[model samples]
Target: DAGITQSPRYKITETGRQVTLMCHQTWSHSYMFWYRQDLGHGLRLIYYSAAADITDKGEVPDGYVVSRSKTENFPLTLESATRSQTSVYFCASMGVAGDNEQFFGPGTRLTVL
Candidate 1:
């Protein structure tokens, strides 16, 4: 029984290069979220999708993109990676109604140079 998975738990990239982070959950939850955890700002939402084909921009959507064509998968892409974007990215998912508590994955540490 798999909960959630993230590819390339650690990543290093150069500025202006495109990078993509992958996330997948086996829970088949309806809501999925992407957040970047930094020092001062804390965890800031980047993008989220209510369901497949229904995605919305969150607090820090700039320089990032997300899509959910399937309930079990949500991928985030960095259009042009930047140094300031270096942070730990987390992928979380919640059920439909009961206990809307989010279950977060280990997280992907991203570093931009």
Candidate 2:
């Protein structure tokens, strides 16, 4: 089922540029998450969706946006890219039960200069 997939595994952009990262999952989980991994910050949640059309901001949501209109897809957009946003972004999902551990995608590495 390829459990989860992320597009443009690698990306590079200049400051102030706009970028979108795509994520897809075959499990059709009701919960999905977006996280970023960096040297100092480690892995921090950026946004999460409880279900289709129900989303919320996470620990670090500045300059970033997300949407989940389908149970299997969640896309993240960076309105204005910045060097600090250069990090590996991961998409994860969990069943609707709300108690299961999450399954993460391969991740997308992005760099802003």
What lDDT tens digits, residue by residue, belong to model 2 across residues 1-113? 57999998999999999999999999878889999999878899999999999999999999999998898999999999999999999999999665787999999999999
lDDT of 2 at 64: 99
For candidate 1, list the clashing residue pairs, or say none.
none
User: Which window of ten consecutive residues has the lowest lDDT sum in model 1?
Assistant: 1-10
Deviation of model 1 at 35, angstroms: 0.3
TM-score leader: 1
Candidate 2 TM-score versus the reference: 0.95
Q: Model 1's lDDT to the true fold?
A: 0.94
Instruction: Point out the worst 10-residue segment of candidate 2 by lDDT.
Output: 93-102
How many clashes in candidate 2?
A: 0
User: Which pairs clash in model 2?
Assistant: none
Stretches of model 1 off by over 4 angstroms after superposition: none
